[model samples]
Target chain A: MIKFEVDNVSVEAKEGDTILGALRRNGVNVPTLCHMEDLAPTGACRICVVEVDGMRGLVPACSYPVAEGMKIKSRSPRVIEARRTVTQLLLANHPDDCLYCSRSGNCELQTIATELGVRQRLYRGQRATRKLDVSSPSVVRDPEKCILCGRCVRMCEEVQGVSAIDFIGRGSSTVIGTAFDRGLNVSSCINCGQCIVVCPTGALTERSHVDEVIAALADPDKYVVVQHAPAISVTIAEEFGVKPGTDADGRLVAALRRAGFDKVFDTSFSADLTIMEEGSELISRIRNNGVLPMITSCSPGWIKYVETFYPQLLPNVSTCKSPQQMLGALIKSFFAQTQGIAPEKIVSVSIMPCTAKKFEAQRPEFAPNGLPDVDYVLTTREAARLLRTCGINMERLEPDNADTPFGERSSAGKIFGAGGGVMEAAIRSAHFLLTGKELSEPKLTALRGTKDRKEMQLDIDGLKVGVAVVSGLGNARTLMNEIAAGRSDIHFIEVMACPGGCVGGGGQPIGLDRESVKERMKTLYNIDRDDALRVSHKNANVQRLYREFLGEPLGHRSHELLHTHYGKRDVLR
Target chain B: MTTTVDSILAEYAGAGRDALIPILQRVQEREGYLSTDAIVRIGEKLDLPAAKIYGVATFYNQFRFQPRGKNHIMICRGTACHVKGSAKVLENISHRTGVEPGRTSRDGQFSIEVVACMGACALAPAVNVNGHFYPKVSPTKVDRLIQDCRDEETN
Candidate 1:
């Protein structure tokens, strides 16, 4: 341990700890902009500068290591001036449209400015002139608002392994741009929007369809129906200040109803439906000498990653559409038929904990007769905004339940929100599909945490099935490389592009009561455990739908509606 | 025509991420400037994204996107030249060529470039035209220089 003095208070820190870490541990808060929890500190943003005794200049507390007998003043007048000046310099180049900006209240840069008492501009310069990039269906990039902290660049390259964007120039003329400075749709961007979630300013945001959704809601001719993703309920609380991981399904439904949705349902119902189709597909593949390892196709970001990086694995991907797409397809086809309404008259919308779902909905295959399965996709944040815009207090509203038919879902479907949830859900259903018997009391506990690549062997009716669950594209790339080299004997691989499945999705609340994936996982798991039905096959509504309409899993009707094909793209454009 | 990028990429095969900069340098050297085709081909060869290759290639000041002209013009903007009003000389040349720095003329006859220095401090405000050097240049001198280049080209 090393001893240090922070604001004249004697403090001891572990050896090799940065001064910021030491001070933060000792209850002395310091401002930081370019630093994230687990990322390597670049000190690109000088907002964390602090005074050190016997030092010539103030050092970045985030990157500077604490030395023995060091005297650190994180809130000294000199340090405060330096930090304020840094923010002032950043503000000089930033756009002056904060009042109309989406992140006006929540932006980290704005918060810091308020704390630093930056009431007026101290410096003036020519702000960077940049065109807004709305090329990607999910993320919008406003380069003029970027402070060039390099967080998104590092997150994309170092964390996600996409390396889609980077610092392209030098000095004051530098700009963050894609390869060749082209639009993002043509680039390798997966539309994950993790960059948007991490951006401290309004430089990045989900391409919102809130206005279109609002217009649809106000359209008297349009019978607007909405569905929330499996992860949305657990994360809505995080966005609404009602404690992180609170299952706000009731309030969420009430808000959606108040917001003028004709029907508000759960996507988990279709997740259960997905399991029926995917489970049957996995069984048929295993029995009929099909592909060895079938990768799950739930996360659209992962789908795009595999399509761009490893096109050869396209065949190995299951032919099932995501639960969101499946539900969208059902609402338009089956629900429309039963309600005696035309598909076009019913405007299908889905609230997802993902930005990539917007891109997925826009996929050409999902649209029949040029009408998209899900007409408009809204992020959870957008849903909250809509609630506010409609004058619905989501917090004070009484809890409610989802609508009929598409409302009922199995616990297995609810677990699909977390990292290993899909694999476990599939395993239970797949085991049942194969042996016509359930796996004992405890589930596949091995595939339940935030581990990078979890591999486990299952003895299911004399067949050794190897399944691997991996989150984050970086780890997925490693597992994919292993599979390519013939070093992996995995039978089923589940990949979520974001770090912790849809619970840690890119379109979740930005810097608002952010909770650990483990905590989020607990909410999903509790929902599953507390429910009466545990397996997808036990969804009575789904069973009846199969009995009445679909006939059976992997049937002709199922293939036409539930399953979809994927082709390798030379370029996304 | 030069050898295909396939052959150039074969030299840096299996180099992966580390080879990106060197391969970009080599591609720029061979192609005169980094082309979209070259960037995409290198991305395919190294299993890296095309945007990533472009990103790394752009960080350094050495890379250029536009092809160079038949005759390249370098205007020194070092401390010595700046002290002697090289900025005025640059503006004069740019106006005469009808192209800004880092751009080629429409006729593809002349390209202008700005350099930090030409390492000729003794001859302040120096300009390097193609292979030859001009010292103590002025706005009128820049106009004469362009006229002289055009005259030589016509002959």
Candidate 2:
């Protein structure tokens, strides 16, 4: 540890800690806009500038290393003035439409400005008019509101390993853009909205479908049904000032019903269905000498990443659709049939913790006979807004159960919200399919947590099976390269594009730190631990659906409704 | 054309990202501008994303993304030239050529660009066309310059 004097208060921090890190550790609040935890500091924003005892000018605390005996005044008058000037400059070029911005109440810039006492615009200048890019089905880019913090760029390039956007041009003309300043739809974007979560300003957001959903809800001709992802119920509580990871599942269903949905269902039920098909597919591949090391296709962003970067591995991906689409397809096929409603008149809406599900729902394969399976998708944030718009406080609502038929799900399905969850769920069912028995302890402790990559070898009925789970596309890319290089130890792989899987997905509540995501994951695991039905195959409703509609797992009807294939996609490099 | 990029990339075989600038420079030099195909090929060879490659290439003003026209006109916009009314000279040249700065004409015959400096401060309001410098250029002289280029093309 090294000793430093911050505001004349002695503090000790680890040896290589930056001034910002040390000050933060010492309970000193230093505001920063361009700083991201666990990322290499760029020191682009000078908001964290502080007065060092011997420095000629105020130095940025984010990138400056803490030295022994160094005296730092983090809130000195000069430092405050520099920070105010930086905020003023950022606001000078920023748009004045915060009232209409999607991030009005939650914008970091507005909060920082209010904290710095920047009541009025001190320096007004011509705001550069930048084009609004709304080409992608998932994300929206309002460049006029961007402050050039480069957080989105770094998150895309460094964290996600998808350099779909970057700082184009230089000087005052610099803007974050895709290749050739083209639309993001044509770029190498995997539609993982990680960039949206990191943007400090209102520059990046998920493309909203709330208005369309409201229109559908009001239409008497349409039978609008809604399903919420497992991660949504856990994280949506944060938007309502509840503690993070609080399971508001029943409250969320009640809230959706209050919002005028004809019926509310759970995506976890379809997640159980996914495990049934995906697990059976894994065993068939193992028994029939099919594609070894078959990768999971639950995350649409990972599927798109493979389609764009590693097209040769398309055949290796499991043919099962994601839970969101699986439920959508079932809603139109089986649910509509059971209700005696025309498929065209049924509007399927999904509330997801993912932005890629919006893109996934719009894929051509998901649409049949010129009719889309899922009509609209709302992020957890958007769902909160929708509920608020309807004057329904989600926290105060009475807990209610989801509709019958497609509402019952096993705890194994509920755990699909976390990273390595699908693998655990699949292993449970795959073990049952292979050896006609369940694991003595169903909880695979090795396949839990938010680690980048996890591996486990299991002997199921004397068959040695290797399984791997990875979240974050960068880690996925590394493992993929190893597999491509003929490392064939693994028989099955599960990959989620976001870091911690659906709980840390791109379209969850904004401004969430890693701790909140971990809490949400813990909540999912807690749900699994407390629940009775823990295996997907044991879910009575799913088994009934297989008997009533679909013949069996990997059957022709399942192939038609619950499974899909991927092909090579050409994108701007 | 793709074969040319492939051959150029062959010289940098077994190289890494350190060879990016040199590869881009060579490709741009050979193609007169960096095409999308060339950039994508370079990205593949360097094992880098094309967006990042484009980002790096665009930071410096040495790269162009479009094919050069037959008559490439560069107008100096340095401090010395600006004080001597190079902006009017640039406008007059753009008017005569019917092309915006840093863009090719519709007919692919003329292109215009505003450069920072050519190091000929003594001759203010300078214009260079097709590697030939015209010192102390006026807005009216832009007409004659276009005519001379047209005549040279005919010859």
Off by over 4 Å in 2: B95-98, B147-155
Instruction: Tell the DockQ for candidate 2.
Output: 0.80
The residue-by-residue lDDT of candidate 2 on B7-88, one tens digit each, is 9999999999999999989987888888999999889888899899889988877788888899999889999999999999
Interface RMSD of the candidates, in order: 2.6, 0.7
Candidate 2, A1-573: lDDT as tens digits = 899898888989899999999999889889999999889999998899999998898999999999999999988889999999999999888889999998998899999999999999999877889999999999999999998899998988888899999999899989999988999999999999999999998899999999999899999998999999989999998998888889999989999999999999999999999999999999999999999899999999999999999999998999999999999999998888889999999999999989999999999999998789998999998999899888998877899999988899999999999999999999999999888988789999899997889999999978999999999999999999999999999999999999999999999998878899899999999999999999999999999998989999999999999999899999976
What's the C-alpha lDDT at position A370 in model 1?
92
Clashing pairs in 1: A179-B51
Could you give candidate 1's per-residue lDDT for residues A1-573 as a string of tens digits? Answer: 898898898989999999888888899879988988777799889899999989898899889989999998888889889988998999987888899999989899999999999989988878767999999999999999999999999889887999889888778888888987889888889999889888999999999999999999899999999999999999877766766778888888988998899999899999999999988888899999998799999999999998888899999999999999999888889999999999989999999989999999999989988999999999989988888888888888898889989999998998999998888888999888888888885367788776667888999989889999999899899999999999656899999998888888899888722246667888888887788888998899999999888889999988889989887876621
Superposition TM-score, candidate 1 onto the true structure: 0.94
Fnat per model, in the order shown:
0.71, 0.71
DockQ top scorer = 2
lDDT of 1 at A279: 88
